[model samples]
Each structure stands twice: as structure tokens, then as C-alpha cells.
Target: MQGSNWPIEPIPNEHDVYFRVHKNYIVNDGPYMFKPRAFVERGDKADQHKSMSTNWEEYSTPEQTQSEAKIPMDNGVVAMSVGGLRSENLTVNHAPIPTIRAHTDVNGLPDDIKDVEVRVKLFKHCRWVINPELSTNP
Candidate 1:
């Protein structure tokens, strides 16, 4: 018939498309490993006196960048290769030992923690890390 038309598919909603990524992509862990608490961030404390946080922003210098690249901290200041959302080649019961080193009271640091270096083991996949290094004061 002259009025006949071919069927057409509707365009997908861009917003809806993004939501499916989490369901489609699969992460394989066989040879990969890192610290258990590597991805954790310190919880924000609500100051009773101040209305809002008094945090200030600072740019990293060339020297600081070099130092940060070499060391990884449990406090999550500097960016390290260990704490990625996706780590491939990881096997169960085979967690790699991660070394953490930080300068004394630097990188948005509090007054308490100081210079430290440690090698810690992560048992399987866990939210919390169990290690002797965490017990000692830096």
C-alpha cells in the first residue's frame, strides 16, 4: 500500500543507558591485590561550633608530586596505584603485600601521624584491614 511505512526503533534514553554499565561490565580478579583499607576516606566530623568546614585547598608542588607518587598512605591523601576501583588478575587467597610510606604531618595531615613505612597484607576481600602496622603510632 502507498501509505505503508517501515517499522523504526526508538532512540534509547542516554540517562537510562548509563545505568546499565554496572550490570554489564564484569571485573576479573586473578593476579591483582592491594591494601583492604586503601579506598577508605576519613569520615567528616561535624564541628559543633563552626557552621561549615574550614578546609582550604592547596596545589601540589613539583617536589610534593614526586614524593606522593613514591609513597601510599592509609589516610587517603595522595593518589596511589593501589586503590583503584578495578583491579584485574586477582586470585582468591592471593593478596599482594602493599607498602605504605608517608612524610610526617604532611598532605592534609593531622598533627598526630608522622613519617611511616610499612608492608601490610590483605586477607581476601574485606572492608577493614588487619595488620600490625595499624597498631603502632607513627
Candidate 2:
């Protein structure tokens, strides 16, 4: 809670919360809502092996993440706890912004199907922390 704008060396604690900006990551149907691909890397050279960017809740407020960090707020934010992600064998690491990475097994190979499973688990553990439609005009 007392850090600078950028993420620091210490990994967030299990009880700590983080937020994922859901600009184009969400799906809305009739009465259902979910993230289509919440934690996948964007395949950009800069984000090749890292999960999508997330803000450490203790270090940043949702408003700051959206405004100061310049993360889009088209949909909203998904609040995820460190412990919750660990349950799915994922590790939350600190980059410029905190990122979620899957824990590799002995083989150290990336499995596409397993990645999908992890994304689903992450989606289930998340809850909306902001609603742009009601909280922002544009």
C-alpha cells in the first residue's frame, strides 16, 4: 500500500487483492457475464510470456488503474485475490504492472487446453469491482 506507481520486488501476499481491467475481455449475454480470455498474453512482443496486466489493489485504487495507468474501462474491472489464483496453480508476479503466470509442471511445456482451464477457473474466482456503464459516461 506504500509503494510507488510501479510494481516493486515483493510479490503480493496471498490475502492481497488485484484488479484486472476488462476493456474488451468480457462477454455479456442475456443474464450471463464472463471473461472470454482474461489472463492470456496479448501475443505482443512486450507481453509474450506474461499474463495480461493487473493492478495490485493495495498499491492502486480502481480509479487510478483506469485513469492514471491508462488501462481502458470499457467494460469494468475484475477483482481477484492472490489466494484464489494460487488455487488454480497460477503465480502472480510483479512486472511494471502485476501479472498472473501459470505454474509450470516438471515438463515445463505450455498446454493450450490447460491454459483454457486456468482461464475458466480465474473467471469463476473473479467478481466485478467496477461498472463503467453506471460509473463513467464514456
lDDT for model 2, on a 0 to 1 scale?
A: 0.51
TM-score of 2: 0.61
Off by over 4 Å in 1: 1-30, 47-58, 61-138
Q: Worst lDDT window (10 residues) for model 2?
A: 100-109
Q: Taking the tens digit of each residue's C-alpha lDDT, what string does model 2 give over 35-81?
A: 55555443244533545456666556555555543456454655677
State TM-scores per candidate: 0.17, 0.61
| Tens-place lDDT digits, model 1, residues 1-138 | 112222222221120000000111212245333332232212233422211111111223223323333243322122222221113221111111122111111022222222122112212222212121234322
After superposing candidate 2, which stretches have Cα over 4 Å from the reference? 1-7, 12-17, 20-31, 38-48, 68-73, 97-114, 134-138
